[model samples]
Target: MYYFNPDMLMMNGSKMSFEEKISVLREQLASADAVVIGAGSGLSTAAGYTYSGDRFRKYFADFEAKYGFKDMYSGGFYPYETMEEFWGYWCRYIWINRYAPVPSDLYGRLLELVKDKDYFVLTTNVDHCFQRSGFDKMRLFYTQGDYGLFQSCSPGGASKGRTYDNEEMIRKMVLSEGYRIGDHGELIVPESAEISMRVPSDLVPVCPDDGNLMTTNLRCDETFVEDEGWHQAAERYQDFLRRHKRLRVLYLELGVGMNTPVIIKFPFWKKTEQNPNAFYACVNLGEAGCSREIADRSVCIDQGIGEVIGALGV
Candidate 1:
């Protein structure tokens, strides 16, 4: 059974009771012509893909000892003295989060809930859980960079952004004499060597015309790539909005935080405000509140997402 701390509940005022919230959600689910799911870090948390604990220690014990980072998210932003260690941590992160099955059935349940509907997902999460859960790829948009994808720093350069083929990179890393394998099959690298290692000059992605180190397509920096796929996805999302402008659209937002309101929360608020027919639903553990303008049409379920999904039987 999943546990929830009462302190995490973020309902600000006496709104609808839990039954009312569930009733409204069921109503919205039944009537929505198109369901748009906006997801954030919380969704993955529900799926048991935490950034710390056994998983973190398994892949990042060395990084933690050397850099003092306690979690994967913090580690990602930590300023490691060298790119090698950074990439090493990131590669392992991508490998596990992207390739490994989630710890729970939460993602699968989410997919089941929306499978029968005309649904599209817009998520800031890079974990690719939706795809792994069997959601149609074409119907989902991962606004943030994906862990599995690598973009060239210069697409046309000789070493232009090539998706770091995981199998290839892992093969190379394992073959390189630099990595140390423990008896438990854990991989380790020397802290000094990590600092000296660059993301291989050759590996640095460049434009097809000019070789440059390829970078993760994440939007954290100016180097984030906006390739053809990005534009196409944006167009599809826009088209969805345009076509469903007058329909009973349901914007089901889950676990969106304030760190990047523009991506999920703000858009949900704006879109719901613009469409009288739209019903905005937010299911966040500790941050489940919405504007008064749409409050009558909103259902803020301040509870654990896993519990919510379980209740839905999705």
Candidate 2:
């Protein structure tokens, strides 16, 4: 049984009725001078971008049967027999997660809620949903690497690789075998039994910087690319905080997880604790709550983010 820690409830609204909590949150949204949205995979999950179960089966049933890896996350780490097989798995992974249209308009709704407000987004999620949802690109910082980006997998001067948008590269590799991307984000392999085998060596994407293999620009190690764009976004986030120090700022965290608590949750908590004008709210399904130190001004809702944000009726 999942315990609903009342202490985790934000804004001291543990005892408040559902509608009452929504009212309080709504009022805060309406009155705040600025909002800082912290997001994680759970936000995308709430937006119907799941990585496991049916979604995985739909895209990777053959891999599951062959490799016994059940979900997309597990498959990423699986040791495949050849680069041919590896790129086969990864291109589809990138196309679906990076290029597929979101099923739910949760991000779009959240954008509507804060479109007019002075806002900044700090997110651990790599899905590029903020830009897709029509949020101001200038105000958003994706702390994690994007799926649509590729970096040199080498270690050296070219090691600190610059990021490249790999949309065209991914499309080319996936189609090299005559596999068409399906309408619902799965791969449609050729009628000929061996679709992935025709994947040519030239189809293997390489780093222009170093002539080495290319890998997704995700944060897997110290080599994760932090090019100019990343630093610029980081600077902007810091500037936003400094500029909004005295305003009624709301640090609204949505679906953030424990994978890297310091990135979003811990920093937000510290900021809220230090700034009297800052208010913190965390809306995660079954994971909503704040530390006791910042409890008075926090609003932690133990509910699905889509449900909570939808209730805001933005």
Candidate 3:
């Protein structure tokens, strides 16, 4: 049911400066009955979880040297010839993004802004940043799946309607690649020897129940599993929306982009339009905006999320 409609996109060329918009956002957050945070990859990027550049180079240098992909995102989709090689790239990818510590406290600062309020998170990001930073698990909906989980490749099995946690296996695979775990759980490249670009054949993950190949729990295709937890979270999100629909609600969007607007962007716009009491605020680096129909009730701050959240001083 989630579908993007380009015609629904709109922006206002407001005369209000960034300072004025920040002031308005602060006022709205304080007064709104509920806050529904719609997050995306950009928020993670803002929180120092960049998918490219030095961060990618630091962890994925072995894979980069072998595959020639400059960024982590590109490496994720590379068609490796063997499962050992595939898992070699992905285990590190999942570990650093999901299990390792983030470079900054941006998520914590964001939580400070809404810790006491009735807030629910709906994010496209697979990284476990929000929960890792102390956000309540029951109050979040990860629409794009998670990096810390794996799903069964078989259509019918005990793994049906289930997702397996990958942390233990990811660690095993990383260690198999000759990487060492740092004191703080970060992956450390061994100083004395080169890291392997492939995992041991036995390290490739398989479904426990059916012995089938396991895939990343990300939502790239129809095969993505929607387990009981995913369903419960979806229902909770709907309940939250119903309870706040006509009240003073703030659709606080952070770092969302146009890749899959229907999941968060379009719905936020639609809901804002439907409820006169609703206010929509977007804080993306460049894609911040709302429908012109609801322009008067919206604020689009095309600024970095970390800067805006920091300025809020919450």
Provide C-alpha RMSD values for all models, in order: 6.0, 2.9, 3.3
Q: Give the TM-score of candidate 2.
A: 0.92
lDDT of 2 at 303: 84
What clash count goes with each model? Answer: 21, 6, 0
Residue 160, model 1, lDDT: 34
Note the Cα lDDT for every prediction shown. Answer: 0.73, 0.82, 0.87
Looking at model 3, how many pairs of residues clash?
0
Off by over 4 Å in 2: 1-14, 158-161, 182-198
What TM-score should be assigned to candidate 3?
0.94
* Residue 199 miss distance in model 2 (angstroms): 2.9
TM-score (all chains, Cα) for each model: 0.82, 0.92, 0.94
Error of 3 at 296 (Å): 0.5
lDDT tens per residue, model 1, 1-314: 11222222224554466665777688789999999999999988888888998878866777788778789889888886755655766666665677655667888888888899999999999888898779998887888777766767555544333344443564344324255544533456666654322345343333343445455667777666665666778888888889999889999998887789889888888899899999988899888877767766777888888877777655
Which has the greatest TM-score?
3
**What is the lDDT for 7 in model 1?**
24
RMSD of 2: 2.9
